[model samples]
Target: MAFRAYGEVQQRTAGPKEIELSLFRQITEALEAVAAVETPPLEAWADALYRNQQLWTIVATDLVNPDNTLPEETKRNLVSLSQFVRQCSNRVLAGNDGIADLIDINKSIIAGLSGIPVSTVTEEAA
Candidate 1:
């Protein structure tokens, strides 16, 4: 059974890996789109970053199935991403820092999800 331990969710429901992978793909695609576009609008980029946070949080919360085993790193990313997204919301959106930050966070998130290392995602960023 999925249970919250020490304020961190822990459990990997059936097919959670698949859902995580799909979410990662979405993030990657968004980054690619932002990269390919010629000077994508600040609003568009900021919006993309915000949406990226939405996607990551949904996955962390288990979009496809119950996910109980979210690592400490995942939890931290989830929180940070949420905050960054919230900060980006309804703003003038005049630069690409938001987008760049989102991209970096996404890469680190995927690395953590891939079992590379959880703390690696949050170390430098935080």
Candidate 2:
């Protein structure tokens, strides 16, 4: 299909950063969409959560890899953030309304990936 062809082209052309940003944007949107509905279907919520967790797991793995180029402090922060995401995801899965934090965290990472300063993102949100 044309759509599949386009996706393949995009995948080949996108740089690592762009690919990461796109993925975060997609997963974040999925979570936000499910959160917006009252009494969202459990299956839908779980699917979104699983995607998010998988994304974070990949990120955490890369952060710990010896070849990762990020500074130590940045890696530490990301690992901690990943841990928090995992805990929050567990709470959400247990019938708690704790998805907002996950969404916000993803938005922050997206902003960073998009080259927006952290202060600017927080100011705009506030």
Candidate 3:
């Protein structure tokens, strides 16, 4: 009951962008946690990667929607990024250790959504 109430309150209070940022943060955290495990169980790794892939896929789809308000260039860039995410995830699932790049991408997106300049986030990461 308490959990349901909290969720209702949160939904009412958080705007769309805030909710998107929060979801990205949560999915990124899951990916990070799995990556931190030195030899994470296959199931755990797959679950994290799957979640991130799903998130990006949804974002890409939404970007192309006719009702989406984003500029064409921005939508194209994001859709391209989402494609990269999907390809990288495929590589990772095929035994390549490429999860770090995906995590960094998610972090960059989170930073952008949080109103921080992406270049600043990239420089900080470097």
Number of the predicted model whose TM-score against the real structure is largest = 2
Ranking by lDDT: 2, 3, 1
lDDT of every predicted structure (CA atoms): 0.59, 0.91, 0.89
lDDT of 3 by residue, 13-104 (tens): 99999989988998988888887788888888888998899899889989989999999999999999999999999999888756989988
- Which residue pairs show collisions in model 3? none
Q: Candidate 2, residues 21-101: lDDT per residue as tens digits?
A: 999989988998898898888888889999999999999999999999999999999999999999999988886756988
**TM-score of candidate 2 versus the correct structure, residues matched by position:** 0.91
RMSD values for the candidates in order, in angstroms, are: 10.4, 1.8, 2.0
Candidate 2: stretches off by over 4 Å: 118-126
20-112 per-residue lDDT for model 1 (tens digits): 665775766676587668787767665666667577557545523445565667566676666665455433255534355555656666776
For candidate 3, the per-residue lDDT at 76 reads 96
Query: lDDT value for candidate 2?
Result: 0.91
lDDT of 3 at 109: 94
What is the Å distance of residue 46 in model 1 from its true position?
7.2
TM-score for every candidate vs. truth?
A: 0.52, 0.91, 0.89
